[model samples]
Target: MRDLVRKYKDFLAVKGVTFDVPEGEIFGFLGPNGAGKSTTIQILATLLKPTEGTAVVNGFDIRNEPDKVRQSIGLVFQDPSLDERLTARENLYFHAMLYNVETTIMKKRMAEVLEMVELADRQKDQVKTFSGGMRRRLEIARGLVHYPKVLFLDEPTVGLDPQTRKRIWEYIHYLRDKEGLTIFLTTHYMDEAENCQRIAVIDHGEIVALDTPENLKSVIGGDVIKISTDNNEEVLPVIKNRLQVKAEKQGDYIAIQVEKGEIFIPRLAVELKGRINSMVIKKPSLDDVFLHLTGREIREEGVNAVDRMRVYSKRKH
Candidate 1:
């Protein structure tokens, strides 16, 4: 996508965002709620049009050839889109028909996807009778019935248990490795974003940082030392002057990024002596990267009012 922008009346849900996903790679958009992840995905999937700029999906321009773009991609929305009254096989069959899959190959395709998601045995079960994990697996199977070049998974593992989420990721990796599918996913879960080959850290309708997980975490440089003291204001400057390193107050702690935290901790403990009330040391992680860039932790939150308005307007129109 090149300079893609989505405006909901006066509110810009998506700023002038730009990025690319390489073929067969698991590229992810990582951000908290209200950060425009869904709005961008909607634009890419042709469910919503951008206010400015455009994108090409599978070699077809989204603006000029929406039908072709739609044909070339599969989208599993953040919310459930499956028919609870229908059996799993029936849902996949409906999707196959909508994509105009050949009659001769439709059954074979449906069977293949069912097996891929390990839902072949339960294919005859009503979606409402299926567990949350099973329903999500069936949704993934339906998305793959047409075998599009790219798959967009919007919070594909949200609301599921840890074990179920792990299972879902297994199928995603299998699709990329065996089916050679390019996966574009949006997630707020830091651990989930780690599964991506590269991630775009978005905030407030803008891409704050984009890189591989390791690269993004490396921006924090080294181990993180979070020191909690009775008097942070008094200790922050002392640590900065004594260690000759930057120390910033994060929440109730003074956070310092340095190499060899294990080595530094001993010296720091000696330098501060009784001044330190508590201290914690750890390696850099995606959470740290987010905090470093955005000044806040990524937590579950409601969608932006503007994003909600955009969706409501789309439905009304």
Candidate 2:
């Protein structure tokens, strides 16, 4: 989508943002909560229209051909979207009917999807009785009933256990490899984003960075050294003057980047023997990349309803 925008009255939920995904590629929109990731996905999936620009999903224009767009794509929302009273198989069957899957093959497709999610034996069980992971898997299976060209997964693994999250990723990879399906996913979990082929790091409705996980981490340029001291104010200048390294104050610690963090640590210890309290050295990560770009952690709590309401009020007047 080119220059896509979405406004909720004066809130401006999504800004002018644009990017494209290759066929059959797993592209991720990686961001913290409420960074416009869901809003962009909603527009591309044709559930919400763009206020300024447009998108094409599976060769169908999201605006001019919404029905075609809907036909070509499947969606698994962030929240559970299943009928608790219905059995797992019944849920899939209902979804198949809504998507107009051929009745002749619906049963076969239902069985296949159930088996794919490893829920075949439990297909007869009511959805309310299933665990959280099982429900998520069932929802994913339902999304594939009609064989969509692209699948949109919004926080697909949220609230799932580590084992369950891993299994879900296995199923996702299986679908991509077997069916050659294109997957567009939104996630706040950094670990989940690492599984994607490419990622767009968004903040405040803007793409701060876009690249492979390795490439994004490489942008940090070296190892990270974090130090804690009783007098951060006293140590900051001494380190800069003696080591000729720029250090950033983060709370009660100082963060420094160097080619070799281990070597830097020994030097730091020798130079300032009694002043340091604690220290850690490690390689760069996605969190570091985000902090480097935004000067704040991505997971920081964002604007609240009252703040948005203030903006809305100003716009109304």
Best by lDDT: 1
lDDT of 2 by residue, 46-75 (tens): 888889988889998999999999899989
Q: Could you tell me the C-alpha RMSD of candidate 2 in Å?
A: 3.8
lDDT of 1 by residue, 159-234 (tens): 9999999998999999999999999999999988999999999988899999999999887887989999879999
- Compute each candidate's TM-score over C-alphas: 0.87, 0.89
Query: By TM-score, who's the top model here?
Result: 2
Report the Cα RMSD per candidate: 5.2, 3.8
Point out where model 1 deviates above 4 Å: 227-255, 270-279, 300-317
Determine which window of 10 residues in candidate 2 has minimal summed lDDT: 305-314
List candidate 2 segments past 4 Å from native. 228-254, 271-278, 301-317
